[model samples]
Target: MSIREMSKKIVLCFLLTSCTYSINAQVKDSLSFIKSKKMSDDDLLKKREGTFATGLPDFSSDPVTGFGFGIRSNFYWNGERTNPLFAYTPYLAKLKANVAYYTSNARELILSLDVPYYKGTRWRFKIDFKAQQNPANLYFGSTESTVGNLRLPSDENTTFSTYAAFDKARKTLRPGGVGEAAFVTDALSNRFRETEYMLNLKADYALGNGKWRIMSGYEIQHLSYKTFEGEEADAINPITGEETSAPNGFSLLQRDYDQGKISGLEGGWISILQTALIFDTRDFEPDPTKGYYFEIANEYSSKYIGSQFDFNKLFIQARAYQKLPFGKRTVIAGRLGIGNIFGKNAPFFEFQDQWSPEGSINSLGGKQSLRGYRANRFLARSLWFTNVELRYRIAETKLGKQRFAFGVAPFFDAGTVRDEWQNLNFKNIKYSYGLGARVAWNQSTIISFDYGISKEDKLFYVGIGQAF
Candidate 1:
């Protein structure tokens, strides 16, 4: 089952393409007036009402998505102008439809809508819904995760021979024997077939001053997960990032092997109740220049919530941004996040996937976070990650009425997952450093491309919004 490309050859009207133009216009116009000293930031905000941005790929591909593309739109409506120093608190509605990827073995098509509305100064309501059919999904035996458990079986009793051969060839910086490459892919990235649909509704109520808020949401997810006939040909041999239509060997999962303690291989339904505490004082929400944001959230899914399986998860994240006075346009930002899953024998799929705010990656070993590795490249019981970015605005230009900035970000990321959940040690951490190029549309939308390099792997990332 290919997650239906939903295919490379779908059709869309002008509403999608024109929104890109609209966003460019607003940003350029605002910047022109500001540079000429003719308009104040407040005046620009007043005129910045009803700004929108959208992207429709001619076609695109990533390591995970194989060959995928989509169209997305974000609408920014000026909800209120309570803070004079900051831009408008936008009432936003985001819509998207696209083919995530397709291959000889699996594919996925996704359609989703996310809407957030601010009611007065006290309450905000939001809804996120998505439907996807995914086949040949990747899994690295992390049911009861432990560091390096998914690596090749190294014990003398059952060691794989081809792994050693590839290790030797890697010294030459080459993708070695096709058989060795295909074997490694089968052993590591086991495939599955699943159809999933999720819906979540969230509410945020401001407390006392507007900077502190309480967040709550109800989410229901349906997953029809099952084993698939393993791919016969490795069109995209995951281990080496090589494109060869060679036959793939049997994956360990197809040999009647299961990764974890819990048993939900057939998939089930989970209803989640999530809540969080947020403290934010950022100068801007999209790409903050000053101030910091801290949030801690929990997800509880139980029999009481109608979950076919029960589990709970805890998440804590913080980010800070500051401006350096020496440069005309320079800022530094850092982010940290932690995730833990506990309670009744947690199912493999229940741990975490596709819950990110941007419909991007939430997995630790992915382009969005740990850029150097493949998606879910590493997994364990608990995860912690850090990101630091130095941003420099290189140029500012206008087209029609849209003002935008071309920027560069040199970033460093460090993260690791532990099976036992103990101390953070450098010996167990994975480090990656990278640089990114971006175009910011009125600080409302950002299109970025990043290239990351690590000791073991290198990756290229293309996506919307900041990596946080």
Candidate 2:
């Protein structure tokens, strides 16, 4: 079965289990003579002041990364509600850690800490560190070329006859296609390996009442690439089917490096300094039901900052949430974002990332952007995208001291990338629509499952929090 099909079964099983648990809990409560106490709003506010922890086993499967397993944990300290800032932020202090391994020979380690209104001061400090290695990362060409390079099974060039011939050759030459050297090169030419380490430190100072803030940060990153090697197989003559000595060809990434189309092939360090202005009036930071968030950020990296190359990036984004009049628990959320990079000295890999005060959005495709496409499926110097979601709470219940909420979100996403601002056109835009399942834990953590489809691909994503 396809990966998307398998993911659907997984989600179905999870929902079934949750339903069973809810039924058992209800029966247990009915059998008990005494009812559980329901805390008032004031009591719940007091409960939020103490330290709390939550975590779950991370399980994920996708065509790009295969099956992945890990653990993610979050620790939070809300401080006293009387502190004045407690109501303005998600938490006074927070720490998050995640570690995972994938069947594709990929591994990841991440740690992050956030302290808003640090020590009763106006400054909010944040630090993040990550180390990741993936042997099967996707790497289509960048810029407008990516728009034309994408290939699917239905494409004219990938006819049945062509696929059959390729398959026959593979079976004859490699027999079972074992080992690194025996594996046939992907006809689509879109796979590579990447190892990366990153460190970032940021500080935000509340200007007035914490509704507006000035953000500044420093980041350092090191990245390396490993291109797939060509397959080594015994050649067979097409007509006679007789074996002969021959070699295949280089991987797509290797070919590009040889042609001098890519930089930082040997890997290097990048140092960057960034600043932004943020205006946030959201009712809640994690799952906002009403309000707006806006940010404009600029980043500069140069040799003077201890970087190997020089480049500049700019990003502008706005997000808003509103409750619908017909449904008491319905919310409409939307976001618009645009970004661009300047200078030709930047590495090709850097073009795949967009940055803001909140976090990084990796490319115009993937879970955070175009859910129907693969991660980093499209890369370019300029990009624009938008997302709209209609979220409706379907159910709510209390399990012990934890509050659980189940919701559904119907979403639409559209985006495109180009080599430059002038090259951008609405005619090239791509769009996808999907429905998502949401489970909110203690009104703080949100578990999300989304399935999206485009003309080119279908993808399912399991993640934390909303796509925005």
Candidate 3:
């Protein structure tokens, strides 16, 4: 069986299953084992669920709007493991989608699909797409352990449309996500503008029980002035979607259209090919209690791939999870990640340190990475970051027919950034710490609320699963 054959079987099976009745009343009692294995890396997470979802607030450095709302959902189904594409391995297929609307009249969409047990003894694959239009000023400078966003408050002349457009892109989002445009900043105007668009495909094959694997992917993206997205950036005013003074000077704060330093300022297609070697042994993925995961990869860009510039990217990362002795309910998790750009022509936007390399353009800080500080708060040519968290399961209970477990986590994060590798400093590291509570379903899906404080600022986030 090939990829096409496997897909056909999955579709046919779904059509057949649709004719069946709900099994809640019949099967609810059979899942006691899932509830008992609260701290174990059980196989339950891989089981099919009709549909699951969660939502979070989108907050930012802008004061105009305290927050926006976003929703994430996953619909799972059985995929044909017997298909040659999967090498007759067991697998599950799911569609993940997210849509968010912001007060700045900005919107974002993230969609993707996964193959069964991407980390299991089978083939792994994914198709990802993301697009966002955010117009806001970001903290972009050369510094360590510090971040500064535009403090330029809205004035009487600063109409609703102006502020709304200025705050479309938030400084941070929970767990995983997309970002808005980046506005250039000037002494008189703390604003700059940029747009982000991307699409990519990837596949990986396992070497041993999915512990060792090879991964490869390709992507095409555009990041530049909001105007390049071919959207009405100011014709009718982005806020009310009606004519306003937004087309004028006060409304258009700062537009530093330059290509010398920030390669994508003018915005064009950035194409790249990437490959990696992965080693993972976590008992479970979402909220692991024990095991280790590691990866190293190289990404290259050139005119041959339609990239505007040429460059090579390298990343080496690792993590470990441990369950305590007194009770498996108590666990500790830690991670170490480092990234480097080998080419001088690599676009600055591409240097953004991101949590997941499958599709990330930024680096260093954010809700999913370094909690306390804002996203993209710190970016250096070469840098390393580390995170640690202590999780304690409080107890277990039931919600209707669903199983639930509640817990808490106190976490700490730190990282070092330098203009170059030789400039790395062991004594200088930015730090942050915080506490959070977790609510899980079937002991697999985790929902969390965390409050992190750092030298720069404090951050509050609610999202799915653990940070790593």
Please list the C-alpha lDDT of all candidates, in the order they appear: 0.58, 0.72, 0.59
lDDT digits (tens) for residues 227-271 of candidate 2: 645534345655588766433434555656667876666778989
Q: TM-score per candidate, in order?
A: 0.75, 0.80, 0.71
lDDT of 1 by residue, 32-151 (tens): 211211223532443344435555463555333356444555544432233221243423334454455454333445454433323223556666677776654666555333334234
TM-score of 3: 0.71
Q: By TM-score, is 2 or 3 better?
A: 2
Model 2, residue 114: distance off in Å is 0.6
State which candidate has the highest TM-score: 2
lDDT (Cα, tens digit) per residue for candidate 3, span 1-468 = 899999858854753453223334333343222222232423343332433333344444443222567776655443332222122222245566778767766667888766633322245678889897665534344334223332322232322212234333221111211122232211212334556788888887766444677888988888765432212233332345543221112221223223144355556888889788878766556677777888887788899989887888788888998889755388899988887777776665656664244344246666667788667767667878898999988887766556778889999999877767777767568788999899876544578888988765677887766777
lDDT of 2: 0.72
Sort every candidate by lDDT, greatest first. Answer: 2, 3, 1
Model 1 TM-score relative to the real fold: 0.75
What is the lDDT, from 0 to 100, of the residue 385 in candidate 3?
84
